[model samples]
Target: MTTTSTDLDAEALDLLRALTGRADAVFHDGQLEAIRALVDDRRRALVVQRTGWGKSAVYFIATLLIRRRGAGPTLLVSPLLALMRDQVAAAARAGVRAAAVNSANAHEWGDVQRQIAQGQVDVLLVSPERLNNPRFRDEQMPELMRTMGMLVVDEAHCISDWGHDFRPDYRRLAELIRTLPGEIPVLATTATANERVVADVEEQLGSGTPVLTIRGSLARASLRLGVLTLPTSRERLGWLLSHLVSLPGSGIIYTLTVSAADDTARLLREAGHEVAAYSGRTDPEEREVLEQRLKTNDLKALVATSALGMGFDKPDLGFVVHLGAPSSPVAYYQQIGRAGRATDNADVLLLPGREDADIWQYFATASMPSESRAKAVLAELSGTPLSTPALEARVDLKRTPLELMLKVLDVDGAVQKVQGGWVSTGLAWRYDRERYERIAAARVAEQDSMLRYESATTCRMQLLQADLDDPAAAPCGRCDICAGVWYPTDVASEAAGRATTALDRVGVEVEPRAQWPAGADRAGVSLTGKIPPEERVESGRALARLTDLGWGTTLREVFAAGSPDAPLSRGLLDGCVRVLKEWPWAERPTAVVAMPSTSHPELVSSLAEALSSVGRLTLLPPLTATGPGSTTGRARGGANSVYRLADVWQAFEVSPSLAEALAGQSGPVLLVDDLVDSRWSLTVAGRALRRAGAPAVLPFALALVG
Candidate 1:
């Protein structure tokens, strides 16, 4: 029986009351319409509303209403663990039973499965990556699909390759959507999609049926936006240190790199602010704790990367600050949307950095797979399954790129993951070169738009809105340009000094390799299993990491392509001296030796000679490359440990004079190099020195690549 509009209105009122715990609660402009489309019309719809616009409420309310009519469970494909937690809590308030199956809750899978089979679960949330799990894909997914009443895709922008933060796993949704019954309602939602992305997503969801696209204005009246172009990283850090306390309430400070996030959090703590760092490397349980702390106003801020981007909820968060600009305005808009959600007059600030472009380039190239590498991986897979490590041995690609390529191939139907590992499916897959090229071009364009945003004379908010193709965008009268700067421009001298000191601190510990990589023996190296502790060099020191806030800027200039070889600067020499002065070794080094440098011989020689002169130690002849491949120039960083070991093993030879000098040394020997990347060079070089009768070897370098 068809329900009357008055009856639907009454039911919506009840859902709103149950969700917000207020009898007078009401829907926003289009919230009730969206809920009715899903619950009454059973239509596939895409909602492009801003953050905190009650998107979750629409879905949860629809789930409850559908379940009341005795429909099957609603299945939601959420992108983040944090989002799942928030959605589950929201569903419970609306009296809809929701359960989640993700990586963090492995032990509860059986209970969740049983609950679903018994019709106790009204909604089930799973991550996009979980859809590719072997057991779930082959066994549980079919059952869920057979009885699913509605399907919702949160963070739907990820489904399009043209989107800024696209993931290969999300593309699997297209195939899943195609199999769904026509009557089953489907909803896709996101806050940051341009015309291009919206069209791409609509096409993916079509499956020969029309989709209801509900796009609203992208403007946020509660957010006041501004951009500060800091000339140096230390200045940016100084600004944050001096100004974070003056912000309205607890919030988030976003950084582009993990090192920057950690460094910023440490400096802020030193400044007596209660802050924590959040990133992809953070432990899952600790992330939950941190999220809870933020929700309850226990932390002043979380220095985070994009890992905390979507679905993190704190309704009254007072500010959002960016330590460096993201690659696109769409991403920046999404991040800043976290603030001013449930409150008025939240501050949004962007401290654009000079190194942002370089960081952006690194990440952009890392995401694109090389055609040769992808083909090589497919060639190696056969009837027999091979693990990632085994595949890494056969293919020269590194671990991260290999895994990402496998994900893409899996979605393309070229491979299947089984109990043992991955195997080819005998399906012919064509490389979509034109599509990839177009995506790369689009990314570049987006980056240029972000740059424009930093320098726009008009409203900053409008620029972002324009980038997202919002037709209703206009001057947001609260921006720095719309109204003159309302924030303090002066950074306290003491705060600047503190930031400089923190950035200038050197000496990062380089942990020695503990074991040979799994497939080392198969790659013509005899070594296997654990590396003997005795043969390993002690944990060493580098003057700075290539990613450090202070030295990073200077080092990038020095290491740029075609940079002339030169001796160490006085500042660098002082840094190296400080590292030596703070050394906590058991015995002072009696001798010094340099690693062979095909590219910067003069720099290496001058560094070793200078250290020897200052420490009053004998300077031994430098080591030399033994074979043709020994001096293959500089090995680019980011290769897996197995490939790095194979590239360096037997590649270096100890000079006779160096061996003689090692034999005469009574205490430890200092092994100096220009840089340490994979640490394989230090490992093999130190091993050679040890075999030459040196009692101990201590590795030191000018820089460490992160």
Candidate 2:
């Protein structure tokens, strides 16, 4: 017999009460509708409600109700580990069993699989990347697709065959859904999807059947959004230093990059605030600990990258301060949604940086798959599967971008990933030129919208909502623009000085390459495995990173495209001198030698000349490239280790005078360059100097390309 609507409501209400631990819990406006669509009608649905609207509840409640009908377990493809943790915990509270298989819990995957086999698990939370795991894809996923009662994709905005989104791998879900039994229900949920994204998702998830799209107001009334245009990073740092404690409660401080997050957290800690840096570089177990600490309000804040964004919950998180604007207004909305979930009010502030556009452009270009790179990768592959490392040797592209392109190509049916590695499917594929261009155009538009959002004076919340295409967009009447500067503006002079000193402190250690990238020999690189200790250059230092908060701005200008080549700026020189003054080398360098640069010859010579003049170290003749590949314009040939090493190997030669100078030197030689990228130039130049008989080589650069 079919379940009645009234009976379904009663069962869903009971599950909701248990899940929320509230005796009188009722569904949000469309939550019950979403559940009924899944459990009753067994239809595919797309949910585009605001973040705190409890999208998880719909899937959890539906899973429980469907399980009561003796259906198989639900398979939840969540985007983040934090989301998985929250879902698993929420399931237990509702007396529904949930298990997870992710990188963090590899040891428990067997137990989770067994639980699922025994009909003990109601929901299985797996990340989108988990779907691509060799074992999971070839072994576990096929079985789950057959047995799973429902498939729910949370944060469905990441699903786009257009090829660039938060998780490009999420496109795999479309294919997975295609293979599922027609009777099984499928649900995709997101709060950030606009009209275009919604259409794309609907097309991907609903191939033949009409998908029920449930969208609610994207506005977050609890969020009082504002923007602060700080002139420099130091001023922004000063603002946070002075005003964090005044914010209502412990909250997140978001940054665009890992370095910024780490730097901001450090500066805040120096000011006596309890905070920690969380990013992709953060260890998996430590990320769990940090998430818990934030949930319990132990740390005053967690300065984080976008890694902490999706579905990480703290009902009372009082504020979110972005040191730099995200790439789009929709992203801004999603991040601010992390705050003010259960509270009547929460602060959302943006400190738009001067480098915001540059940073946005940097990330935007890397994400979209390039047509030429795709062809290059495809050309290098045959019918046989080749490991990623082996392919890296054959292709000039770097590992990360190459992997990302291959994933998109795999989804597009041009390639397939197997147990060994990846193989070309020999299926004729056409590059979606128009689709990629449109996607790029959309990103540009979104970025432009973000710029307007920052400067708009009418209403901050309404502008953000409108950017997300919310029909209910209206003036919040509470933001700094709507109201008048409610947040603290002035940074104390002492705080500014403290921030200046903290952010400006230079000297990033450039660790020497320890081992040659695998498959180097295939590219004609003689080096492989660990470098001989005697031939390796010692750990070196640069004035600062081009992406750093302090001197990075100046260095970026110095090295920006089309910028004129000039001697080192006094500011950078001062920072470099400071690095040298505090240098922790085993012994002071007795000689200074400049690494030849076609890009910034004056800058390199001036740095070497000044350092030697200031320190009274022996000045040695510089080495210059004169071989066949020396005309490769920029010194670094390729991004990957194999190509870079091959391009620079025996590329630079030591002059007689330089060899004589090195032979005469009784101490380490200082090798200065304009910038350090790939580090192959330094390794090659330093090896030449060491062979010519310098006791040690201490490499230094004006900036590191981190």
Candidate 3:
């Protein structure tokens, strides 16, 4: 039921009619009820709903009610210029008086300010970055605030320090809200929020403000979730190209890094697809242009980091693909949510591989420290007057960890900057100790949360929905697990499984008979230039040897010729069947999997050296396996390349019971094997170790043989 302006009581309806139109100013029943409650009862309402669920519309419609009843303008604070412009445009189309203060033009801001002063603007949208401007708060908004009836914060989750797109200036909004007039109602809206985020929003909005925690259901009935696991990053890109962006409707391809976004978009463009790249580093004007292109369907797909969507409304998105895993599930959820808003049959693809986690870990290690190191650093900095940069240099903490520590300090008011350096803002001793302990505790808790989410046994969607207080939550039947892992398989499932097995079978059966193409058998098989296999197979061999090493490694055949059809194709099963029926190496499944282990250790080391020569692969430490059941196998060659796990057991020469005792450790076991003879064997061993109580097992395939 819609409660248009005409539905109000005679007095209110008459006033609304007089101010606007004669008829049909209806509002959604749900929206109107919430609006009335917010205005009459004075609540800090957080309207949590998915995109295209009319969350903003509800708040805007309520603005009219408040305007009819009160004497001030509604101030909408956002952090995206594109969103501000869109909102202003939306208001104009709806025949509402709205203006935005943004960077589209310096001249426009002056006109907006003038409109605010004249009490003619019903809605005002400004970026939070604008709030930092003195003229906005001190001169412009002061007049509007006196006449402001309500404060609406859109995409309010951005204010949360824990939010994926946290803006530091949002912290100042509380003071801005307080400066407004006459018990002004505060309305906040967001498409996504976890429990911690909700609490942060409440805290930011000021205390004792009644918050309407409306957690909409997580199920997007139109969205189909799929997962694709590729053996290499190059293979992953190929999969994305043929599956995700090939579709007709507007889509978003999310990559983990800026370089990935650039490369992915470049590849798509090369393939003659209309695509654009967006990341944090993208210029504001360029970002706006790309976003507008996406909205209008002028661009078919956008390869971007998570910085593209946020408050910008692009409801026509047909699908979203994560070309790589994001830093956290929070980020993944936010990025994927950009799709499937108003469209039917929207698809989301999560490209799977352990490499994603490894990349994330590398970034994590670069920014964060080991638990003991974090503790040591915090303790060293405890009660010490040091600026963030000074502390970073002292403790060797990277930017992210340093920023996180500073935020924690600011939140607790434990440290303050006085001129150049930092100083304890409180009674230095107890405060410093407590803040240090608290930050440590929070860090531990966060780590636990990350682990829990990573290895959660429940339905992923339910777990995500449960993080929010979505009361009507159930398994999203579209997710990987719900669609198969925890439920009976459908025809699609049987077909997909058979397709995978067939592809594997074909690769193994034909690989031996099939020869490497042209000069592919050599050290460096180049479409452009030739180089020695020894130099090309291994890192640091010498780029001078192979000037044009096509973006493929010579050491392994993980993605060999005639790979399965692209991820989205239903015909992959048929394609696999055809390959199995014809390919020469179709009979060599074990050899196909074993090919990487066959490459000489020097080759790998050389490759590693070559990459490192230019600085790529960083070898950490080689963990050796020692157990009663461990035996020494012959090295594939003179180098430390081909020693086997079974061989390691023979060398240890202990009984199975003793081996179990030693290998069944409670923490992560980094098993050193000269060669991973079979991924299947490693899989079995890993499962055994895990079942025997090892938390996790990391297999390091070292090449000891030349």
Candidate 4:
């Protein structure tokens, strides 16, 4: 029953025609070779091609040919939910039966399992996170692994620590692949991997088997790449406003932050453009709707963050514009690859911003947990199981970092998550200090390369390809440097004014803490349950968020470490006045009180004095910090609410004179501070004022940390 190479080639071509619905469709240079390695030779293969190079076709065709000879279902490990949906549809079009089990489709998992047991499903797709689920790992994965005909790792670059978007969950694949029988063929594919990432992935995949690496040219002839250096964020927004319509067709507008995506989308809609915002915070249903809208050309663009980066298929997407540069050239290349996939001419532009570096630094360190924090987490879980919130109360780590650390531990076989919660497995684990340090250093180097890409004199596409280690990279003749400037360099004054107005309209409602954090009593605090609506402050306002596009730059410069703490400027005073003018509170403040500030005492005192003079109200003596050391230091910012509250509970004390003075006030008192981050400071301080007989407390700040 052995099939000859010539027969296999003819069958693959026929399947490709069915997959693409084009009679003349032919495999790209390396696509057929990759498929042959997996199907005919039964060898491990890794395919690195550009976005539009038909990587999925290789796996789909191989799955069909293998199944025709009566092999088990193909197990595809995809990254995103949107990707699963698109892949399921594509499989159906090619006469393949595919089923997916993920968080979004939880209700259908039982049915999917039944289908797999009945031998009805030809391929099964899953997210990497599912591999660690206790029930599936114990009950289903063993059988699936034994019976799987082939293994596919889509978006394979995530498996390497050297990759820009490395996920700890992906590391689990190494163990899974190691356990597979030698006869099972395997395939890994990615469009964005450099020499380092490729080497790492190949080594992980091969383990002891030899892996054939097939890489094609990374150049996209239809894409026209360019970079526009804008001096300020406002100018970048202005450029989008003035020239977005001039771009070829519907595409994506990427931003480095979620707030920027939202703000940019709002501005674009106000200017009469059909656009919507997409981010991780978006609702699942809404995200699906937005993807469809963009696909059907119902919307001109989607202002998005990296959440929309991979596996989003729009064959004719017209352009990609960035409000701020990504941290690395690899990520930049992948994002821009979304465009010109199936079109003759598409635009790719980068509007570099000054704040891009700060954003990059924040994300770089956010993923790497400190050794002390990791030990604390392990120690807390040494005996008993605890939910995420319970663990957060016991450890000083925030929710995001704590979860990330737990995933790392889970993948390393040091912990297990069960029905009750997460528990330590009593396994000895070592903190790889050298590895994390190397990762941090690599991140800094990548940031430097991105800067070079912005300022490079040669073709922009060539710079990106060179960073990705594409050996055949050459100057693309369609780029700005080679073909002259294709995009406008000027922003109209009217459009600039409109962008200013949009970014300047700043008033984010500070939600009052409703319920007490779990395990509050463990920190020696007796408070529990709701904060009693009466004691809680109403929705308050800040002059601007430190992450806002308008005043963020100025606020960052003013609040940077070692910067001089000067008196309130006229502009700040004016902004405060405007905030007050728009206040929707039922009662205005008759008195003002300042939070204890050990860092910016001058700034807080000046702001309080200026408000007192402007409002003709009495300025109470400021509260004092009673703790020995600086409790409000920056290191405490990322602690949980319970820990943050405990740190500031005994730190602030209102003098008896000030308390007595507050007892005489008739209306609400304004509680002012230089900045508001955790809101625990304002919560505890507001409780003190309420206990002192003020009718209500209103929290106000010059800036808020988003």
State residue 200's C-alpha deviation in candidate 2, in Å: 1.2
lDDT of each: 0.88, 0.85, 0.53, 0.88
Least accurate 10 contiguous residues by lDDT in model 4: 628-637
For residues 1-706, what per-residue lDDT tens digits would candidate 2 score against the true structure? 5779999999899888888889988999999999999999999999999978889889888998888898999999988888889878877877878899998888988888888889989999898878888888887887788788999998888896332264667988888888778899999999888787899899999978889999999988888888889899989999988888999888999998898898888988988999999999999889999999998999989999998988898889999999999988878888889999999999989999998888887787676666777887898887578888788888877888778888889878899888888988899988889977888888898899999998996898888888777899898888888788889899989889989999878899988976777877877876678877777898999998888888888888898879998887787788889999998999999999988777788888999999998899988888877764432423433357777777778678889988887888888999998888788778877887888788989999988886
Write one digit per residue (lDDT tens) for candidate 3, span 1-706. Answer: 2344335534343433443354755543356556665656667777777566667666666676677665578888877776787787767655568878766666878777777777788898887656645456567766776677788898788777556543555655766665554377888887677777788787767565556666667556666665555565555655654554445498888876675676667766765678888988999888878888998899888888767767666777888888766656556666677777767767777765444543454344232224454443456456757665555544434445556554444434545444545555553322345533553454344444544555555566666566555666687777666675421212233334433332222211100111122322121222223322321211101111100011212212222234331221223233323432343321211100011222233333333233222322233222123432222233211111111222232232223553455453433443323233323224334334444444444433322111
Candidate 3 residue 667 Cα shift, in angstroms, is: 55
- Clash-forming residue pairs, model 4: none
Quick one: how many clashes does candidate 3 have?
52
* TM-score per candidate, chains pooled: 0.98, 0.97, 0.58, 0.98
Give per-candidate clash totals. 0, 0, 52, 0
Judged by whole-model lDDT over C-alpha atoms, candidate 2 comes out at 0.85
Output the better candidate (1/3) by TM-score: 1
> Ten consecutive residues with minimal summed lDDT in candidate 3?
539-548
Q: How large an RMSD does model 4 have? A: 1.3
Q: In model 4, what is the error at residue 97, expressed in angstroms?
A: 1.4
- Candidate 1 lDDT tens digits, 1-706: 4678788878888988988999888999888898888988898899998998888888888888888777889999999999899889888878889999999998898899899999999999999999988878887899899888899999999999987775999999999999899989999999999999999999998788898999999999999999998789888999988889899999999999998899999999988999999999999999999999998989999999999989998889999999999999989998999999999889999999998998888787677777887888899996599988788888777788888889999999999888788999999988889878998998899899999999999998889889999999999999999998978878888899999999988888888877778888766789988877667787898898877788877877777679999998877888898999998989999989898887777888888999999999889988887764343423655466676788888789988887888889898889998888888888888888888888888999898877
- lDDT of candidate 1? 0.88
